[model samples]
Target: MVRQIASRLFYAIVILLGVILVVSSLVKLVPGDPVDVLAAGNPAMTVADMEVLRERMGLNRSVPEQFVAYLGQAVQGDLGTSIRQGVPVMTLILERLPATVELALWAVVLASVIAIPLGVLTALKRGTWVDYVGTFVAVLGVSMPGFLLAVLMILWFSVELRWLPASGYRGSALAAFGQAIIERDPAVFWNAFRYFILPAISLAFVMIAVNARLIRSAMLEVLEQDYITFAAAKGVPGFVIVIRHALRNALLPVVTIVGLQLGALLSGTVVIETVFAWPGIGRLAVDAIHVRDYPVIQAVVLVSALLFIVINLVVDGLYRVIDPRVRDD
Candidate 1:
């Protein structure tokens, strides 16, 4: 396990470095001068002055020099300051990462909680109302676009029902729980949760549907296998055999889906964040792009790529740990 983990870590680092190098080059492909965008409407500078300013900021450097400098600064954990905002790129990402993390974790948890049991039950009752319902859900999950879901959720939950807060993170849950406890309010955490539900559900509903179908299929196949039959013939408790033996075998494919969905959530939350007014890293990246904040754009891309690589490594290592059969593969 140690050897496997070490190997995965080494590969993840290499992938992250390569991604960073690519992003450093790719940010330059954006069709505008970041310095001009930053200095927009500042009548103090002429075109020649702007050129001088760009040279001083190293924007005029050869791509090789720029990449080398970027790598050197990145090695020291300096993701560069945002040219547009005059803030450290890392600081901006860190401030917003918690919200993104909260959203991603909640989305996965909700998807798993809803999907796993439905899938097992659907498999258990293969040709019935329950199975039909699961199949319908899977189709909907596959078909419904997340942004549409996000909009529908906002209208139904936020505008119509008044049951939950509309959008964005709010600190008000801390108020109702008493002033002293408010400082560390579990209530505020609950506020965070309440705001999370709509976005998380919108993000997760399709995933739940897909997972349910996969789990149902996998569990059905596993249940029909010899070991499950042998356990049943041996007079083992039915639930015990199903839960302990059948479920473990059923989870192999579901685990792979979990990993992929999670990585996608981390990468693809931009549209959701934009729609819902969630201040996640994705939203920040979008704003940076609109303004041609070159440094921030590069930092965002590299950070997200690094995150994806790390998640893949973790998922792969977890798979190896869970299934010895996978090692042979």
Candidate 2:
């Protein structure tokens, strides 16, 4: 198992490097000149001054030399300063990373908590209203756009019901000192949650549907196996038979999906984040794209790619522990 993990980690690093190289090359291939952008924005710059800026920024370097320099800087964790903000790319990412992490965690938790159990129930009660309705809901989630759902949620909950704040994360009652609700301010975390509700739901609702449907299908299929009948004949309790025997086996594929979605959730929430006013990496990446912040864009994409590689490693390692069969192989 250790050896397998090591091998997988090695491969993951290789893939990550390859992806970063390709993405960095593509960023430089963009038509616009950053030197001109800088000069235009700096009204004091003459044409000669712009030429000096271009050379200083290494826009004058040969492509191969530039690529080599980028790799060297990236290896040293110097991801370069943002073109628009003028802050270090890594610094900008770190500022927003915590919030994005928290948001994604909440979203994933919301998705899985909502998905897994209903899925099991749907499978167990197949051909009934529960199953049909659940299936229909899953279809609906997959069909609708995430941002639209977020807007609808805001309209219903915030505008109409006045139940929660419309946007932004709440730091703390201690931090703000104005919104405290007593000995314990449930308001802060709770409002943060409420603020996240629409964004999280919109971001994860499709995921929830997918997971539920997958779980339901897996359960129903597992239930039809002869081993399930044999277990029943042996007087194994139904719940144990389902949870211990079937669910564990079915979880392999589910775990794979979960791992795959983690990276996607980080970078794929752009539209939803914008509509819901949720601050996350997706929103940052979109901004970087519009402003042509090459460093920020490159770093964000690299982060997403690295996250995907890490998730695959984690899931593969987990499979060994979760299933003895994989460990043996």
Candidate 3:
């Protein structure tokens, strides 16, 4: 297991380097010079000024030389200064990282809490109305685009019903909870939750649908196995048989899906964040792209790729825990 983990880590580093190199190269190919974009607000800036700026940014160097320099700085944890923000790229990312993490974690938690039961119920109910309803929900969730859903939800829940805030993030729930403990005020947490509800639901919509469908299918297959049949024949309670004998075995595939989706949610938040005006890393990346801010864009891409690699590694560890066969292999 240790050897396998080391091998995966080595591959992950290679993949991350490849991603960084490609992003750094392609960002330069984007039209409109970063120097020009930077100078747009300063009308007195001249051609000479732009040239000097380019030289300072190392844009005057050959691509290979620039890449080597960038790679060395990256290894030392310097992602360079943001062209647009005029701050360290890593600093900007760190500021927004918590919001993105909070959103993704909440979305996954909401999806799992809702999806698992729905899936199990649908499978157990089979041809009943409950099953039909669950299937319809799954289809709707799968078919609806997240942005569209986000818009419609804003209209209904935020604009019309006025139950939740339409846009913007309050502090994360953890921060709110900490403040609440310090001040003896519980409303802080509620405020954060209100701000979180719309975006979390919007982001989680597809995940819940997909997870439900996957779980339903896995449950159906597991229900037919001889162990389940024997458990039922031995007069085990219906709940115990379903939960222990069937659902536990069915969860292996669900675990894989959830892990991949969690990683995807990190990268997939751009649209949702934009629509909702959530101040997260995804929104930050989008803003950087408009002006072709290479440092910020490259940092975002590298960080996202690193997150995906880490999630997959964690999933591999989960496999061994969930199934003894995985350990043997």
Number of the top TM-score candidate: 3
Compose the digit string of candidate 3's lDDT tens values, residues 280-305: 88999999999878888988998999
Give the 10-residue window scoring lowest on summed lDDT in candidate 2. 171-180
TM-score per candidate, chains pooled: 0.91, 0.91, 0.96
Please list the C-alpha lDDT of all candidates, in the order they appear: 0.82, 0.79, 0.90
Q: Of the pair 2 and 3, which is ahead by TM-score?
A: 3
lDDT of 2 by residue, 1-329 (tens): 57766788798878877877787778777777777676667898898987887787777887678767877898899988887888898998887666666667777888899888989999999999999999998999899988788788889998999887678765422333345444366655464456666677777888899999999988888888999999999999999998998888877788889888776887677787778666667788888887667778878888878777877777877887768787534
Worst 10 residues of 1 by lDDT: 171-180
Q: Provide backbone clash counts, one per model.
A: 0, 0, 0
What is the Cα-based lDDT of residue 142 in candidate 2?
94
Q: How well is each residue in 99-123 modelled by candidate 1, as lDDT tens digits?
A: 8876888889989999999999999
